[model samples]
Target: MKDLELLLKNIKNKALLPVYFLHGGESYYIDIAVKSLENDVLTEDEKSFGQTVLYGKDTSIPEIISLAQQFPMFGELNLIIVKEAQDLKLGEDELKSLEFYVENPVPTTVLVFAHKHKKLDSRKKITKILTKNNWIFLSEPVKDYQLAKWIADECKANQIKTAPNISHLLADYLGNDLSRIANELGKLKMVMKEGQELDEKLVETHIGISKDFNVFELQKALGNKNHAAALRIAFFMGKSPKTNPFPMIIGNLYNYFSNIIIYHTMHGQSPQVMAAAMNVNPYFIKDFAESARFYPLKHATRIISLLREADLKNKGLGANQIDDAELLRELTYKILNVDRLKVSV
Candidate 1:
């Protein structure tokens, strides 16, 4: 992420590079980088004659090199962007050609490889050359636990204020799709009042994630051992299968209980220490502490097993023709009473 911020800053400052080999499993950053270089490096009139876009499947490394070797027709520089560079078939000859071009790229051309959804082999010579020159940008995907903080940071950067737990609520619903999350945030920014802070109600109104019936609330209910509240939430979620997918529900529960187990191990530690250990925001430390108190380490471990069993049943492994709604209800019941169940830890 620092590399991305630096890359954007450089582009904004017009500190151009000859060749940018942007390869990564996350396409959001790749798209942003490609757009910045394509738009910022060339003036509007200059882009007419100085820019060329190509796709990996439709071209070869030799052809790209040939384009890069060309001088700008009308401006001080030429821009050649190769989108979906990951799909290009790179054999030994192609690798050699790429390595040669990267080693001695033309000064008048800014060549970019917008590789997405995968990373180039690190052991490759061309990869090393690009990395050594600081021309490579590897955009790794954000982990699930880190999504909330990423959301909060983005909001702060955009001057969009949010209430506590709003980021967590969004993270639970949106998962880890950064692009989708950004789009939703953009929508919120557009509709928010001049000084309005985004809260659970606003998010639910705009994003369609129910504040009361979401997995986060369900987790809280179960953590507090409020059996009736947990069942109510589970039943509502089960009725609306499209909004609350069974697998997602099970996955969230699994993460929740896993964090509780972690909390047990880090008991008596400072909130900061526990939050870091669990990869969660310190704001939610009390929630984890309360959950750990109710479930304890052994019960939390057993709940994880129950979640896995429900997952298998949802997949029809041994479900006896049970639907997801029933499975969710049963899973919720089991998790709420996991303390009372006689099971191995």
Candidate 2:
């Protein structure tokens, strides 16, 4: 729970110690940590004299130490940043040397070890040495419950106000990829007035969600049994390359029907019980509930079979000239009960 503001303040004030290990699961923290060093640690003139960025896999500890040992050309200290330090060759020998260096790091140098993706093994001798001797900041990913708050905080930092639900919707649509989420939010920030609230329509218009529609959200609407809403989304998606990218669409379709099948199979179970039984998030139970209302176990099985055929057609089997848009529209009409079934007289 390290404070981002405190870290930024230390970087800007030049009050930070020489050695810093910024390793974490959250990309937002890792990105901010590195950028703060780049922008605030040294002046442009100081950077030209002593700043060096090195990749861990390519550069050994000896090489890093060699550079760190050198005095700044005309600056007070050198700044050595090791990106993706998890890939850096840090064996026993290197760890011993690094431990010693960290203990007595040159006052004329600043060494920053950045390990992104996941946390480095702090239990290791090298990591243990670092914790006892230098500044160590461990960043963890935001919990699912905290994601909306995190996004809201990010917007607030930029002096923008995002509607609460909008944040969750963005988080829901973007998945859990922090970098991608940040990119989308950054794009949204540009088009929004400073004090204006961001809404779903604003997101739809500016973010360029599939003009024709995407399987992702369409699945959500259908699962929730909002048939009308689902149909509208389906029609919109009919305008896009989504239908053209038949394989991807088919994949999503297959997953949706499969989940519905699973829900029906496990009907009469509690949300927790169903989630555990089907290996899905509990948050998805509502959609499954809605889907169960519209589809019996038998109908769910039939839809799953239809999706299987669609998958094959998209894969260039059976139908050689199956147009994605046409196939998808036909499927939508059937799914939404818009098309009447024919009976033998």
Candidate 3:
């Protein structure tokens, strides 16, 4: 993100690069950077004659070179963007020629590649040259642990404050597909007052998440051994299978217990240290500490095993004909019973 931000900042300030290779697994950041460049690289009047889009499946490396060599018809600089560059069929000789172009690029043109889903070949000589010159911007996906913090940062950047752990709730409900998360937040932001802090109620009302009852709340209930609350949430989840998939629920439970197990091992660590280690907010440290007392390492391990069993059943691998709600109910019952043998650790 920093590299893309820096690159886009330079472009908006008219400090354009001779070559830009945006490549990697994450498409959201790549799309944002590409759009910014398309909008800022040339004026609306200049774009008619200066800007051109090329696709990799249709354009050869030789064709790209030909386009790059052309002088701008009515502008100061020509803008050439190659979308899906990986699909462009190129032999070793063509790759060598492409390398030569970037090495001695057209100063009157701004060349950009929108490579999505995968990165360029790191073993290739051209890739080495691009990396050495800091021309390739890698757009990596956000780690699972970092999604909530990222959402909070995104909200802050858009001038909206989020209530305590509200972003975490969003992250819990919205997995980690950043583009979808951003789109939902964008819609939520339209109705939100400027400087208004986004809260659970607002998210529930606007984004259709049941802020009062979700897998996140269910996790909390199980952690605290609030059997009634846990069962209630599980029943709700089972009733609305469309909104709550068994795999997603199992995933959340697995992560929750995984943290608890880690917490048990680090017996004397401070809240800040533990929070840092677990990649969660310090405010949530208290809950983890409290939950650890209820679910020791022994129980956490067993619950993880139970979640795996539930996962297999959900996948229809030698499981009964029971519905997801029944599986969840059984799993929750098993989890609540796990504490009875907590001294195994």
Give the best candidate by TM-score: 1
Where does model 2 exceed 4 Å of error?
210-226, 232-345
lDDT of 2 by residue, 248-278 (tens): 5665566667777778887788889887775
In Å, residue 190's CA in model 2 sits off its true spot by 2.1
* Ranked candidates (lDDT, high to low): 1, 3, 2
lDDT assessment of candidate 2? 0.74
For residues 31-132, write the lDDT of model 3, one tens digit per residue: 898899899888899888999899989888999989998888887899999998878886998999989998999889888898888988899999898988
Each candidate: how many clashes?
0, 4, 0
Compute the lDDT of residue 235 as modeled in candidate 1. Answer: 93
Kindly report which residue pairs in candidate 3 clash with one another. none
Query: How well does candidate 3 score on lDDT at residue 199?
Result: 86
Tens digits of per-residue lDDT for model 1 on 1-345? Answer: 447888998997989999888887788888888888877888899888999999999999989999999887787988999999988989999999989998899999989999899888999999899989998888999987788889999999989999988887888788888999999999999999998999988998999999888888889999999999999998998888888899889888888888899889888899999888877778889998888778878889999889888898988898699988889889889988887897654
